[model samples]
Target: MFAGVDIGGTTTQVLLCTADLAVIDSTEVSTPAREGGQAMVRAALDALSVLRARVPSRLLGIGIGAAGVVDSRAGRILVASDSFRSWAGFEVTATVEKALGVPAFLDNDVNAFLRGEAAKGAVVDEPYVLGMTLGTGVGGALRLNGELLDGPHGAAGEVGHIPGFGDLPCTCGGRGHLETLASGRSIRARYGERTGRLLTARGVAEAAADGDPDALAVYEAAGAGVARAILITAGLLDITTVVVGGGVSRAWDLIQPPMLAELTAGPPVSGHPIRVVRARLGSGAVAIGAASRARTELDAVTRV
Candidate 1:
């Protein structure tokens, strides 16, 4: 058995899986985002204990998918969003290993999301791909030749922070980032700016579904921004296969038309048509991907 944990800003999910990564049991807990790293880990530990109690197999190892720039080699979070207090610089894998008495591995949450899709979800078995997650914030990851690439600074596929989308300020203190145009929070803010009503992203989607021109325009702009980012990635990396996920992607009906239009308008120089699809694993992707990572690491250690 192996344990997979995904620690998000609002919730922490834990999954117990077999050697092949089939989930045997799972649980979730509210994350103490403002309370500090130790509290958040404790919440994950508590949920993990519940799952472990339900499963009879001995856990072989653990893998953690956390929201931040992770140093996979060091099993630590190098940088995190402002939503998490004291998350950056947290010794995640070490602390979890000490608490659970097992070998552990860690990676950025977006990386894990892409790995999950490549392993068993939408882009299963694909060699080269780009993954985007448009939640409260946007995140990205790259997979090439069947392996995820984590650059020296662990920010190789950080497409959200790249500038030139618009003049809006990003949560990372940058201006003209893709996140400002495509993230869930940004969608809501954009809609609120158009009409003085502050609606949630979901509400805006609902309004768009009802043919509200303002809402439609907002989603179209977001789709265009996303398309531009995808095009930039394709041109740079020669990766035309893209998979999108996260809360904002739920409004695929509202976002896809303009995105496809933009992609069609400017074909890549390589002439390869871009293929974009929604994630299939839903909210379970991170945990499953984490378990897959644990299995891979454990197998490597055994060979060594």
Candidate 2:
């Protein structure tokens, strides 16, 4: 058996998987976001303990999909949001391995998401693909030739941070980034800007569904932003298969038309049009992807 943990801003999920990658048991717990990195690690460990108690199994190792800029080789956080106190520079993998007495592997959450999708979810069997998660923040990942592409800087597929959005402030303190217009937070902010109504992203989507022109316009802008992001990625890597998910994606009905419009507005690149689709794995993608990362690493060690 193997263990997988996905540590998010609000919750932490732990799952147990069979050798064949079947998730047999799972548990979730509220994340201790303000308590610092050590507390966050403890939360993951607690979730793992819960999973083990539910189903007795010998875990070969643990894999973690954590939010932040991760140095996967070091198995630690290189940079992170202020959401988690002292999260940056925390030695996650070493600590987890020491506490659990088992091997552990860590990766950026979005990278893990793509890994799971490529392994068994939406983009299964694809050789090259791009993935985005449009929730609290926009995240991106790339898979090249069936492998997760974490470049030397560990920021290979961060399309959300790419520039070209025209001077709007982004969550990362940057201006004119894609996240300014496409992230879930941005959608809510955009609606508030138009009507002075404070509503969640879901609420804005609901308003759009009810034919609110302002809400519809917000989603349309987001759709255009996503389309431009895809085109930029396609132009650089020539990988046009995109799998998107997260809370914001639930508003696909509102965004797809504009997104598709922008995608085809320009001539096809290399005679290949973009093919974008929704992620099928839902919230479980990160955990499953983390587990797959652990499995892949184990296989690599065995061969060595």
Candidate 3:
């Protein structure tokens, strides 16, 4: 059996599936932030230990999907949560392997999402795909052929930090980044700027769906910003499909038109229309992708 853990700030979900990626057991627990990554890691291991004790099978290893700039090549965290201090560049995979005595694999959450989509969801039919997550910030990853493209520093496909649009503040302490203008927080904050209403991203989407012109305009701006990213990425990577996931994608009607418009206005493709598609696996994508990574790594280790 193998384990997959997606450790988010709100809730942590774990899955103990078969060797073939079929889920055999699962559990989720509220994350405890007081202890930071240490506590969260312990919680995940505890869950896996409980499962190992229950199941009558050999435990292979664990896979982790983290929500930060994870450096998978080094199995370390380059940058973690903004709300907490820092565990910058800490070798997480080695630590987890040492603690559990099982091989472990770590990956950025959006990278995992891309892997999941490529395997079973949006990009199942394609040989290459891009996955973008639009929640707290606009996160992205790319998969080529069947492999996740982790850059030399394991920071590939971070389109959120790309520049070209109007200047806006980003969580990474930079201005003019893509996420600053197109992310969920930025959308709601922008709406608050115009209407003086402190609404959530969901509320803003609801207002847009209700035909509020201001809300619609907000979505238009977001779409334009996101389209800038797509245009730049297409020119750089030449991928045919872009799969958008996360909470903001729920407002696809609001964001897609402008995103598509900007993308289409750019230099034409070679008769292949650029596709901005929705992620079908949704929340499960991250965990499933992480598990797939675990399986791959385990197989590699066995071969070695």
Candidate 4:
């Protein structure tokens, strides 16, 4: 079997899988932020610490799906923010390979998530897809004609830093980016400051479900902001499927209607009907995708 590791802001997941991507074993663990990137790598290795007994031999090489800009070709984590302070400039694939004595394929977390979904989960076989995660911040990816649009610089689907937005600051050191308006932290901060409820984004969704007008309005604004970004993305890219993922997906009851309304309202330039929907696999998409990558390695190892 091959191993796939998906490292996120709050959690990390590892899985072993067959060549066709059927999961054989899996583990989930907390992300070590205070300990930073090196510690996080250790934790990832530990996640699979028990897999030796389940496999025939030393398992296949590992593939890491990490948060932020990952240079898949170079096996490096290229971007770091407050959420992933330890990952900036870390050559995670090399470190893990050296430490564990296995090859690894590294990629940005969102890219991995999309690849997972498209390969086996929600958007599989779809002609085009725009995967957006509304967790701590807004992370995005585009799959066009069944290929990931990672761009030459590995920053193609980064919709978080789009311009012409509001005054909210982004963790990426930019103002008016989509993350300031659409992320879970941004939603809670904006609503908490305005409504004085100090509720988390999940809590706000529950409140909205309970018919709290203020909380409902918070989600409405968030959906509207996301709509703006999605519309721009679709217009520029000609994509039609938007799979909304992350903590915000939990608030779909409050967010979906408004988000759809904005999409249907039509962009200034394009009037194509883009379908916006909830992510099918929820938070598991990353782990599932990582598992998918691991499955690829399993085939290679058996062949060798």
lDDT of 2 by residue, 214-237 (tens): 999999999999998998888888
Please list the residue runs of candidate 3 whose C-alpha ends up more than 4 Å from where it truly belongs after superposition: 50-56, 267-271
For 195-223, candidate 4 gives per-residue lDDT tens digits of 87798888888888899888888889888
| Model 2, global lDDT | 0.90
Q: What CA root-mean-square deviation does each model show from the true structure?
A: 0.8, 1.0, 2.0, 2.3
lDDT of 3: 0.82
- What TM-score should be assigned to candidate 4? 0.92
What TM-score does each of the candidates earn?
A: 0.98, 0.98, 0.92, 0.92
Best by lDDT: 1
**CA-lDDT, candidates in order:** 0.91, 0.90, 0.82, 0.80
Worst 10 residues of 4 by lDDT: 51-60
Q: For candidate 1, lDDT tens digit of each residue in 1-304?
A: 9988889999888999888777888888898999999999999999988887778789899988999899999999999989999999999989999998999999899999998888789999888899999999999999988899999999989999989987999999889999999998999999999998899999999999999999999999999999999999999999969999999999999889999999999988799899999999889889888988988988998999
Residues 134-201, candidate 3, lDDT per residue (tens digit)? Answer: 98788999877767898887779999899766777788888889897778899899899999998999
Q: Tell me which residue pairs clash in candidate 2.
A: none
Higher-lDDT candidate among 1 and 2? Answer: 1
lDDT score of residue 237 within candidate 1: 92
